[model samples]
Target: MTFKSINPANGEVIASFEEDADYALKIRLGEKSFDRWKNTGIEERIKLILNLAVILEARKAELAKEISLEMGKTLKSATAEIEKCAITAKYYCQIAEEQLGSIEVSNYAHKAYYKYEPQGGILAVMPWNFPYWQALRFAIPTILAGNVVLLKHAPNVFMSATTLEKLFIEAGFENGIFQNLLVGIDKIESIVADRFIKGVTLTGSNLAGSSLASLAGKYLKKSVLELGGSDPFVVLADANIESAATFAVKSRFQNAGQTCIAAKRWIVVDEVYEEFLNKVSEKINKLKAGDPFNTESDFGPVARLDLAEKIEGQINFLVKKGAKKLINGVRKGCLLTPTLLNMSRDLSHSFTEELFGPVACIITAKNTDEAIEIANETNFGLGASLWSQNLEEGEHLLQKLNAGSVYLNSMVKSDASMPFGGINQSGYGRELGVYGFYEFCNVKSYIIEK
Candidate 1:
């Protein structure tokens, strides 16, 4: 099958490529690469990854443009994403030795220690929204753990995916360390089911994550999925309204609201609901939606025209369901204005659905209990933000948010040092920090009798 990558900014065909890998070839390459990479010393792997980090920094601008042209992320944001990729690589390079160091445990029968051994070739199915960062987040730790990578990147970011492979090779990595399989979604099941592929990691929609998880389970292989999130941004009556509203707008509108953990629902206390709404709406209107290549543009076009249409469709549905439109939903090419919808009813589609654009659904709550209830009503449990002046109340709400990560007076974001993942429909297993490095590792136990 042939896949054509279209520019999201104006719907022009940027490039086209044919799917080239068969099941047999994928299996063979994975097995062959695993044999070499799994046995390579950790120091050597770390050295190569550090070199890749250097390469990423030197060619940051080039990679940023590729991301912008292919996926419509602003050039500035794309550059930041590349820099984040370099940071991820550098993080593993600096800490792999200590992080993966063998830990000795005392036992009654014998002295045993756990050795962090590679789980062979890992299959990463990444998303286009964060073309580089998503891939690097998984690649850095997996490679540093002495495992080979087989990336089946999002079809839209094909050029960036191939460029990443070249960057790894240029950094003096041996063949098979990081391989980009230019395969379509149809080919993923066979490649993932292969006996040589040890585990799978994905950062995409809930539907895709569920399908991949089911496939991985059919083969009894390990899988880590970071799926969709309808994260709540809850502001209490005692919170700093100005600061909370500012962070709320940034959280919901960043990446044109394409982020998985973007604050989709804003639950504000009735005491300050009107004030918060006015502040947030003002900020939203200030965002400049234009060409992603422009340095001054705050918002860019959605990754694809279809996504924009989907978001618009959701807005229409909300309008039909008695949602009062606080801001008019309009589109120019793939660019969409940041919109706010006040859902008239509590269990409406506008309040329940994951709006993957700059559409924020405001739900007014009487108090803290109501806010928590509204926040946990969604199936997703990825991330949540709680804003309050009271430290005790903020901490208490964090404990009750039902999310993997909770922030107080801050936006929801993943840090390299923190373990990031979710529960329920948001998917399972953890990524980032030491936990992520160990995900693709084996913990074998040994016993001896004296």
Candidate 2:
């Protein structure tokens, strides 16, 4: 089926792309690319990615505008996302050699070592939220490790997908090192089932991740799925309410709250709940939501109309379920107002479900034990944040939180230096850091007798 990507802000058609490749063709292309890319050394792959990073840095303004226009992210955030892509690419390039190099081990047996080798080809089903960054995070490492990639990007960000393909080509990459497949969702199962695709990686919703994981399991193909999150932003009684509130606004409202790692649930101790809420409300009120191209704007429209509607539905559902609305919801075109709900009970649908927008659900607890209980109640365990005046207290709570990463007095965000992934229904495997690079590699142990 052919789909057209429209501007979420005004419902204007931005571009229409046809589903172009079938399973057989995708398999053939991937196989062909693998033969060439797999033979290319890590140093050569690093050079190609470094060239792409340079190209991205030079055209940051142009690429950022395209991303903001197509996805409705603020120009500033879009630019930052673009810069992140470049930085990630350069990071992988700089470390590919050392990270992927052979490792030596000294033991009782004569000589033993291990070599990190790449898988043949990987199928990447990327989301549009952070269009450029998500794609690069997967592509750079996989390619640097000598693996070719087949990208099936979200339909809404087709232009960015095509632009990414062109950037690789311009960077002097061999044909097929990275190819964008303009295919519909129906074709994904067949593509994943293809023998040429050694593995799969996805960054999307929980349902999407589950379905893809099931398919990958059917074929016993390795997969890394990074799904939705209801990350908890905990504020202890002894914490700095003002500082915590400032970071809370950034964690919740950044990217219009489209981030998977974005802090969705705020669990504040009753002792400081009033002060924390006041400071957070003030910060949210000060944010400017308007045209993404406007320099003064701090927020932009939701990625699409459907998403905005979903956000509205979630907020209204909470209100109808008897949750007190501290800040009422608002929508203008595709833009959704920042909303905060005071959820008193553990209503199944209240703050438990993932609401992918600028809505923060505040749950009050008497102490740290109650706070940790509420945080672990959700099925998602992507990431969580804890705020406390005592560093030891924050670290202690961090150990109890059932999440992949925990931050102390900071927002939950993915960094190249840190491993990023989720536990439970948030999906499996990881991305970023040395562990992420090793995710796509086959660690082969070699033993030599003296």
Candidate 3:
């Protein structure tokens, strides 16, 4: 069987790649490559990553275009995603040596320290949205810390996957150091169970994360999962209403709203509910959803026909359950119109499921306490944003949110300098930052007595 890349903007097959028939050989190659890569100094890895960043910057336009063609994200957003990846690479390069250095436990009569060491090959199961950013976000730090990556990218974005693999090679990565395995789901278990594959890291749905985590556990391998999120953008009564409305539009609709950390739920207090809703709806109307290649377009397609269909179905279900459609949504092919739904607090129980599209749900709260209560109603606790002019109160309210990351007057986003992950059904384990570098490493304790 072959993995086909279908352009979501139009029903066109851009390319197809045959599944890796010799995965065992590839695993062996990863094993061999890891042996050498793990032995290489951090300084050497840093140099290569610096080169990789340079390549990413130089080919930003071309790479962004490929991303747009494969996944249907607007050219501008795709370019920004590529830019973020390159910045992340450079960030890791700057911090890797210090972060991976041995931590001095004690140094009296006996010297003692705990060091971060590489653990063979890591299998990365990445999703299609923000394809390059998601893969490199995990791979950069993990690889810099001395692990090889066997990436199993989403099938629809295989061109981006292969392009990344080629870019790794061009940046002087060994044949097996950063290999993209064009394999199906059936092939994952064996790869995870292999001796060379030390651990697994996945950025996808809760179901996928559960299955992969189960496999990793069955094989006694470590697993890190960054899964689905129904992140809340809480607009308190005291917030800068104008700014909150503007950012709410941006956070919900960016990447056509397929983001894991996007503000999926807008929990607005009663005081500013109508005002915030009106402003956001106006912004939504002004958005230009068109061809991914179009410079003038704000966003594009949903990445697949099924994804668009799924999103529409979810909207319909909510509407039937008495959710008021403040702004109607339209679906044509893979392009979905941005939607806004005013959800009754009684139906708060239904907020658990994620509608991965350019759709936003506003859940009204009587007050701040009710707002926090409504925010915590979901099974997903990925990330959230609390908008309030009172900095202290916002910080205090943030603590009540059940999410991995919480921001005050800002949209939830991933920064290379900060650790990013989620809690509850959003999945376990952390990615990005120094903590992420240690996720797939062996934190070995060393002691020497004279």
Which candidate tops TM-score?
3
Candidate 3: lDDT over CA atoms?
A: 0.92
Residue pairs with clashing backbones, model 3: none
Point out the higher-scoring one by TM-score: 2 or 3.
Answer: 3
Candidate 1 lDDT tens digits, 66-180: 9999999899999999998888888778888898887877878666777888878889999999998999998889888878889989898898988998998899986677888
Model 2's alpha-carbon lDDT is: 0.87
Question: Which residue pairs show backbone clashes in model 2?
Answer: none
Local distance difference test, per candidate? 0.87, 0.87, 0.92
Q: Estimate each model's TM-score.
A: 0.97, 0.97, 0.99
Q: Once superposed on the true structure, which residue ranges of model 1 sit more than 4 Å away at CA?
A: 348-351
Could you tell which candidate, 2 or 3, scores higher by lDDT? 3
Per-residue lDDT value at 352 in model 2: 61
Reference-based lDDT, residue 177, model 3 = 95
For candidate 1, what is the lDDT?
A: 0.87
Winning candidate number (lDDT): 3
Residues 1-450 of candidate 2: C-alpha lDDT, one tens digit per residue: 677888877889988887884546756877888888888877778888899999999999999999998999998999999899889888887787898888999997699999888878889999999999998888888888888888989999999999999999999986678889998888889888888788999999988888899999999899999998889888899898898999988988889989999888889999999999889988888888788888888788999898898889878888898788888769987998788888874763345678888888888999888988888888899999999989987898799999999999888889888889999978889999987677777889999997
Per-residue error for 206 in candidate 2, Å, reads 1.2
